[model samples]
Target: MTDSIVRVAGLTKKFGAFTAIDDVSFTVERNKIYGLLGRNGAGKTTLMQLLTGQQFATSGTLEVFGASPVENARVLQSLCFIKESQKYPDSFRPDHVLASAPWFFAHWDAAFAARLVDDFRLPLNRPIKKLSRGQLSAVGVIVELASRAPLTFFDEPYLGLDAVARQIFYDRLLEDYAEHPRTIILSTHLIDEVSNLLEHVLVIDEGRILIDQDAEQLRGSASTVVGKKTDVDAFVAGRDIISRTGIGGLASVTVAGLSAAERAAARATGLELSPVSLQQLIVQRTTSDTAESETVTTTDAWSARS
Candidate 1:
């Protein structure tokens, strides 16, 4: 049986002339990591805000923890949202923020937070306003991890952290989650970096849910075929084509899943099949038609390789 902690139906958020999160709906299960992915201005942030009750929805229904999240202390208590530009008190220091986290998060882990502070090399005494962009981001990362909320939202949480610091966050998150499982929703532009960490993915494009599926399933859901233009056309005739490009006699086409027999058939026909990465697949799925227009053809594709 599926355990859904969050449920939304026909949810929509509009801002006068613009529709930020247009009619969208999906479910979030317990004890899993979800990636809310999309291109810039695709309404990723807007959706997160609506879920966290930072903004009221223009229409539709959404429930968190079996109740509306808007101004509900009970529901809000179980959520910790960490964003890139997370603000702090004017005079607050890294130590101050960590010191006060427990007041807001019932499950806040001081010891774990301290360990993360050291791991990120965050200065305790320095005022937040004086910290570098990376150091500031670390402060938020520390709190979100240590909060241990039942449902945590990390919205571009590692904005300025260097590669090493980011890795530390990922490693610690996975390690801690193993010991204390909880539902986590992560929204970021670094798809490839967090791709492996994601168990499930919810891709938003143009304020609508574009792709919702298991990360593992998405890994081998698409394949690119390369060979002669005429041969490629014949092979992918009725198949879902994602994007296609050609020069002279050579052509490259991406298409949806193909059965083992189909793959063998393509190989026999002298066609080269390559697996599409999660990032590449989402890019192909959400890439604007104007941009893909330069590629030559259209349809859409997914690979059956696991």
Candidate 2:
């Protein structure tokens, strides 16, 4: 079995009365791409900061590569964290950043970095402060892909890039990852775009982990059952329904944990079973009417039946 590269148990971080991360726990396996997904202000960035040792936890433990990452150069050396709002000295040019990268990343690929620079069309001589937002993002992407760090964290690395540029970044990342396997945690809001690239997914909602599971397993975990009102209601009875909708005499319900026999039974009843997109599932799981209420509430009727 592959070893766990990152482990967290009961990790929590607070600021004054506000908790940024609340009793979160999960493990990241080696050489896999994980999507750290959530809505805005959902503590995704805070959690990434904790994992990378940029911020300390208020309570509980965090282990990266079997050791605490805090003030440990050895642990930090194996990581490359690229954030959306990365900053550089006003006087420094794009070439200066590339020149300094080799000193930090032991496995820096100068040739690959050069190629990426050309591909992104970054102006090496222009001062970084004067570059467009997209160009700055390109600089970060180039360094991250060329660094070949054992574990990399990209927190919305494609923030300012257009569709074409984003595709370039994704293509390059996939190509490099294929050749050199490494652990990657990508925290982004673009769920559907990167859905296929993820092996696992970690979703945070209101400073808590709402979902942590294999990507493929999650894809099949929830489905929408649609048909006549009576048929759909009967088929989804005693099932965990996350959301429901109706039009005229028909009803569609989003449900979880349906087995083959159960699905076959639904099909037998003339109900249409449609796959739920990852984005749709997540949005449903995180939406709530009250701030205190947890997202994705199961049906009380289903519980009683079970």
Candidate 3:
């Protein structure tokens, strides 16, 4: 891996006596896109706040480009944080935000921002407070993309964007990323939407790392097999099953790993196999511990075996 653009060791964040981020340590390599995933209240935001120096770490160290980022102008100037509810001064208009970008971003692209405004159909004259949620989100997208920060943190950048605008944002982001690769940390609940764009995923559940792996490896690590209930059970009897479900004589089993031998064996049993997607994996990993997950038990998921 290239030198880490972001490094956190024993990073901790406390709110009064409650600890939000608990000694989280990780390295984000330069020029890579990382998916920061978790459900609500998973400390994903806290981690981002620390990395971007929005808030101080209670304990441990945080380094962006090999130096303490807290109050460090050199580091802060190269970073852009797109927040969920990006606030603006009351009555401030979209044009005002654009006018101020040059002061904050060293390489601010005025032409790109103007194009985005046109594409997003933002009314430059309208006050930020008067704009709809979707328009507000579009404003942040414009700034973040046009700013071209070396380390960009997109925290739920599409909070209220509709499908069409969201697609536009994704398309533009990918196009720009290809031409100008940088370290990006995207935190969002819309896992399935950006699953393909994520090179790596770090999943935190209730403030703990639930899953961390390359997207490709994660895709291959599990598979769902369906067939006669008995045949399916027999085929999965000795293998590691992540989850399963069944109705009557038909059964669907999600298992880990499928070697050539296993695939051949499953085919002989007339079992249908399909790859488990990243979204499915995240769902299985995060929701299994809940009491309601028992409803999924009769379907015969091997997640318990994990």
Candidate 4:
């Protein structure tokens, strides 16, 4: 079994009367990429902060590298957290940020950092405060990738990046990770884009863990069944239905925990079956009731076009 790099039990973080992270518990394994997924205000950032020692949990135990990360130099040294809204000194230039990175990360690679600077076309001499949003994001990506820390947390690192730049980041990350394996937790809203790169997924909704499982297993855990309304309803009866839509005499319902045999049986009954994308499944699971109702209306409209 892979070693657990980070562990939490009954972790909770609250601000006044509001609970940002409510009694969360999970283990992050070594040498795997984990996707920290959630909608806005879902406490994904708060959880990252707790794990990285930037914030103290209100209750429960938290451990990183087998010790409390709070003020622990050894545990802090193994961490590299890059945030979407990262801030740097007003007087600092891009080159200054790159130059100072070595002090924090013992495994920092100057050569790799320089290569990434060139790759992103970042102006090293330009003052960071004057750089555009995309350029600022590139700087963070460069540091996190070149740091090569044992445990890296990238919280929506591609906020202002364009399609090409985001692809570059993903490609470089995959390439480097293959050569130097480590634990990486990427928190992002771009679920489908990075779904293939994730080994494990942890979803947060309303300050709670809604889903935690292997990425491959999650993909196969839910399926969409479509056919005559009566037949589809029968197949989905008593099953865990995530969402459903229908138009005229036809219907489509996404159901969870349908085994391979169950899927084959649906096909045998002349019902069409399709796989649900990771993004679709997560959205359905985490969206609010009002948003889900809106989705159902939208789905019905789309089904009418078919």
Model 2: what TM-score? 0.91
Q: Which ten residues in a row have the lowest lDDT in candidate 2?
A: 297-306
Q: List where candidate 2 sits over 4 angstroms from the true fold.
A: 290-306
Question: Candidate 4's residue-wise lDDT over 40-74, tens digit each?
Answer: 88999999999999999999999999999999999
On lDDT, the candidate that comes out on top is 4
lDDT of 2: 0.89
TM-scores for every candidate against the unseen true structure: 0.91, 0.91, 0.92, 0.94
lDDT agreement with native, every candidate: 0.90, 0.89, 0.85, 0.91
Instruction: Arrange candidates by lDDT, descending.
Output: 4, 1, 2, 3
How many clashes in each structure? 11, 0, 7, 0
Model 4, residue 298: C-alpha shift (Å)? 10
Model 3 lowest lDDT segment of ten? 297-306
Candidate 4 backbone clash number: 0
Please give the distance, in angstroms, between residue 79's alpha carbon in candidate 2 and its true position after superposition: 0.4
> Taking the tens digit of each residue's C-alpha lDDT, what string does model 1 give over 1-306?
378999999999999989999999999999999999987899998998999999999999999999999999999999999767787889999999998899999999999999999999999999999999999999989999999999999988788889799899999999999999999999986677899999999999999999999999887788999999999999999999987778999999989988899999999999999987787788888878687753213223212211
RMSD of each: 4.2, 5.9, 4.3, 3.0
lDDT by residue (tens digit), candidate 3, 1-306: 678888878888899988888877788888888999987889998888888888998999899988988999999998999677777889799999999988999878898888888888999999999999989989998999999899988988888888788888889889889998888888986787888889989898766677778888888888999999999998999888788789999999899989878899899889999888777777777774553465345223433321
What's the lDDT for residue 200 in model 1?
Answer: 97
